[model samples]
Target chain A: MTTIQNRQILLAKRPAGMPTEENFSFVETAVPKLQAGQLLVNTLYLSVDPYMRGRMNDRKTYVPPYALNEMITGGVVGQVEESLAEGFVPGDIVLGNFGWALYNVAAAASVKKVNPDLAPISTALGVLGMPGLTAYYGLLDIGQPKEGETVVVSGAAGAVGMLVGQIAKIKGARAVGIAGSDEKINYLVEELGFDAAVNYKKGDLRQQLKEACPSGVDIYFDNVGGTVSDAVLSLINKGTRIPLCGRISLYNLEQADIGPRIQTQLLINSALMQGFIVSNYAEQAEEGLNQMAQWLKEGKINYTETITEGFDNIPKAFLGLFCGENTGKQLIKIADPAR
Target chain B: MTTIQNRQILLAKRPAGMPTEENFSFVETAVPKLQAGQLLVNTLYLSVDPYMRGRMNDRKTYVPPYALNEMITGGVVGQVEESLAEGFVPGDIVLGNFGWALYNVAAAASVKKVNPDLAPISTALGVLGMPGLTAYYGLLDIGQPKEGETVVVSGAAGAVGMLVGQIAKIKGARAVGIAGSDEKINYLVEELGFDAAVNYKKGDLRQQLKEACPSGVDIYFDNVGGTVSDAVLSLINKGTRIPLCGRISLYNLEQADIGPRIQTQLLINSALMQGFIVSNYAEQAEEGLNQMAQWLKEGKINYTETITEGFDNIPKAFLGLFCGENTGKQLIKIADPAR
Candidate 1:
């Protein structure tokens, strides 16, 4: 038997606004020897989500604070290298809350093994995972888009936004997307079949949104809040529904500042804005995954991966999310156990 | 034949913030004789909802603004003195959108005949009317309370709030209320059957709310939006739903004062806060009314009304709303049609 070691990214300090390189530190440590009911995992892909910002702050919130000097944990896809559990495995792919680490050891029951024959293992961190499930329930369950309705999704070229806009189109509704770059906009409209794509960096969003959706937006899938939310909110039609999935734009702010009062507008249009955390629908995760996978196989749903080469670039990968650098689902790939 | 003219309350000027009696002037006008397809109504009761504040402003809204020097209009219950249209006749009690006037001449189709044998015609302006319907759909459709879930409603002793709390209890959920006065608090708990009531003006609302709703709030029916909305927001359970029916607390404010930053809290809890206009649910009005009427008859649902005497005191009644002087539904008793 060969002894194993792991390299992980730990939180060096809590961030004030935007996280810097100094906030994360790379550390190499020997992987603890597998005890009874424990399995050694070789991480294949690590997910970087917007919510991690909340965990980084040592403040009172829904989830516990990410302790300093601890590995930054999130959804990860891994290959089982060795197991001391009943189900002996030498090369089985699994998924769980692993961290920004190359290899680690966890209890066998803590990780769920994935079927590679069905879909790529990396998908367990993306479209067949949390972001995909968020788009599904947030749009269909909360927003409840009806036929002929106009659905506007911000961060349109990103992982969850792309799926949300595509699903809206599949449901026979008008899909409008808002992305940062022209390339992302092109991908959303030309490649992803969105009705319109607005480049938020370009000025006159309110005017562009009004022109693109003459009838007014019926559903707003809010991923990037702030000015985008305010602009989209002003153009909503009567009885509009807003599914608040993520507010990536405001995640870095120390405190919320005075902005255009959307509350007054909400009263006028009788519009609805609701925030959702994907974990609330965990019990129904299988249902969402099954449906999403089926749509993906039928080419009805589309997804892309913004991959960084190694675990060392994990900080860059995470910081890149705040800058809107990644094209789709931001992920970091580790060593392939099969090799 | 008595041909006495009607006295009407006209808006002399648009209010800047809190409306004063000086802004309105009562004027004697000749009552137009009923023509073909018209009905002459002796107004009995006129509703004073918080939404009227928007109408008081000469700006674009879901409904048209009240014209300067024209009679302020809203939900009204009256008795038909004369009619030329089919189905409607003299002595019929009806409800419609009539102004703050002793007499009104309108198209017969504009009025809905109410059966006095079934319930008091004045109720058509209170629990059996717009306020009840507002509470009904706002709580059930938007709030979506589930069994054993904790539901908290602001303005709990008032018309809409009282009904929301009761409805929450009926759905097998714990109902907590927040009111201004100790009397209202007692009434909410002892009379209306609210599981708990918080006097927002008396004590630490955040602490009181925490102790009141130990399990956390699943649905929050918000009629008063300010610090209370912020407090309720902090204590919301994951996937909680907020039905923002009214913001009586903020109607008078001029500047863009910043309330607590709730976007972060919303993201953490995955709570949903939606602003709703009851007219959006017009399609379901019949169903809402039927269910509410049934509930009222069975004594399962209860409501209170703060009736102000005289059409001349219409402005006073309107002003009373902003001060939270009214307990339940606020109405202006225009005249006793039988007298």
Candidate 2:
């Protein structure tokens, strides 16, 4: 048997604030042989997301914190290089939480086969995957955007935010996007058909948001919580629904972020605010994926990926998420499958 | 018709922060004649609540702000002195939104008859009225306290809070009360049958609340929002429900109240928080009142009123609400019905 070397990235230390390159360590090790009911996967695409930052801390979150020096795990699209499992065959494209590694020996039950012909193999890690499912349930179930209602999305150019705004529009609601840059704002409004887009980095956010939402905000899909959220919350109308999907803006703070208390605003409008993770709807993920895939096929939905080439650039891609360096999904390409 | 002298308390000026005696002005005028379909009612019990503080400001809320120099209106129990209406007659006791006055001539449609035979007439201003209904819908519909769940109520000795804690117990949930004083704490535990009670004004509130709730809080009925709520929020469990009924602490603040942003906490726990007024559940009020009356009959629910005697004392009574001088409902007694 030929020996294969695997390159992996590990969390060197828990971050005190914004993570730097020093927080990650790289290693090379021999890929382990797959036992019975196990499959060897060669990583193709690795997803980098904002929620991964929470897992780096020592504190408990929805997912357990990563131990120091351990390989970090996240959504990965790969090809089965070898299979000792009954259901999987070599050359099958698959997706699993095999993480920041070039190769992984995972149990068959942990990985699901992805059809490359369906859309694209990488879509399994972005739109047809966790980020798409996140936007689906959070917007339709929690935000409940009604027809003719105004729906405002923060971090509107990011993976989940972009999909959320588009989904709101498909539901017959007016979609307003709030992005950090003018270019992202233009892309969201002009290319994605967002009803309006505001650059949070420019002008008065409150005034810009107010001008964007003439009927007052009925649904707020929040991915960036901070002053941006505070501004949107101030404009919420009666029965407003806020699906709190992420707080990327405050994720790097070393101390607690302070702002005006939102209880009074919520009470005055009889509003609803809920926080959720995509896994919360795991039971309904299939249905959500079907609808999302149909939307993609019909040209009602579209997605873009900011791909960083090479295995060693995974950490760089992950850190770039904090700086809003990605327009949609952020991924690192490891290697193409052997034909 | 003989002319009668009426004494009214008008909102002299909107309060800058906490209200004072000067914010109210007493005026004397002729009691308007009862026209067709109108009933001339003499005020019996005038309710004072934390929600009224919002109305005293020139800012909009779920209810409109009180206009300066206009008579302030709220829930009031009165006796019909004369009636030209079909359903109401002289000597009928009723409840209406005619407030801060010794007398009023209101349309028959505005006031509903209170059955003095079912409960004390004052209960129409407390247990069988708006406060009780507020606790019912906010706790049952929003809080959704299931059996064996831990339910925490801030301002647990106040009008709506007392009922909220009691309702949690009736549903077989553990009730934890947070009050400002030892007396109120004792009333919650010993008299009202709350499972555990903590005095927020005492040493180490977070530690005390942690001790009182062996299980993490699952439902929080928040009447007081400040440090007390911040402590409770820190201990909330997965799927926790918070019904934001009032924010008495922030109501008097002249500036924005700053606190740790709660979106991350809500996301980490996958929780839901909703704010509601009792009027949102108006259609279900009859079912709520009937159940409350049954509970009272079965000794499952009990209420107390901190009553102030005389029409001249209404301003003092309204001021006392901010100081937490009331145990349960606070009402000003204008006059007893003349036999």
The model with the greatest lDDT is 2
DockQ of each: 0.48, 0.89
lDDT of 2 at B177: 96
Q: Model 2, residue B335: displacement in angstroms?
A: 2.0
Q: Model 2, A1-339: lDDT tens per residue?
A: 899998899999999999999999999999987799999999999999999999999999888999899999999999998999998899999999985898998999999989888898889988899999999999999998889999999999999999999999999999999999999999999889999999999989999999999999999999999999999999999999999999999889988888988998999999999999999999999999999999999999988889999987888889999999999999888888676
State which candidate has the highest TM-score: 2
Where is model 1 more than 4 Å wrong at Cα? A59-62, A86-88, A117-120, A257-261, A337-339, B1-3, B146-148, B283-302
Q: Candidate 2 lDDT, tens digit per residue, B1-339? A: 689999999999888888889999999999976789999999998998888888988778999998889898988999999999998879999999995888898999999999889998999988999999999999999999899999999989999999999999999999999998999999999999999999988899999999999899999999989889999999999999999999988888988789988888999999999999999999999999999999998999999999999988988998888888999999888888775
Residue-level error in angstroms, candidate 2, position B32: 1.5
Kept native contacts, as fractions per model, are 0.47, 0.87
Off by over 4 Å in 2: none
Please provide, for model 1 over B2-25, each residue's C-alpha lDDT reduced to its tens digit, 9 standing for 90 to 100.
Answer: 676889989999988888888898
Tens-digit lDDT string for candidate 1 (A39-149): 888888889988888789998566688899999899988888888987848798889888678887888889898889888888888899988999999999888999999
Docking category for candidate 1? acceptable
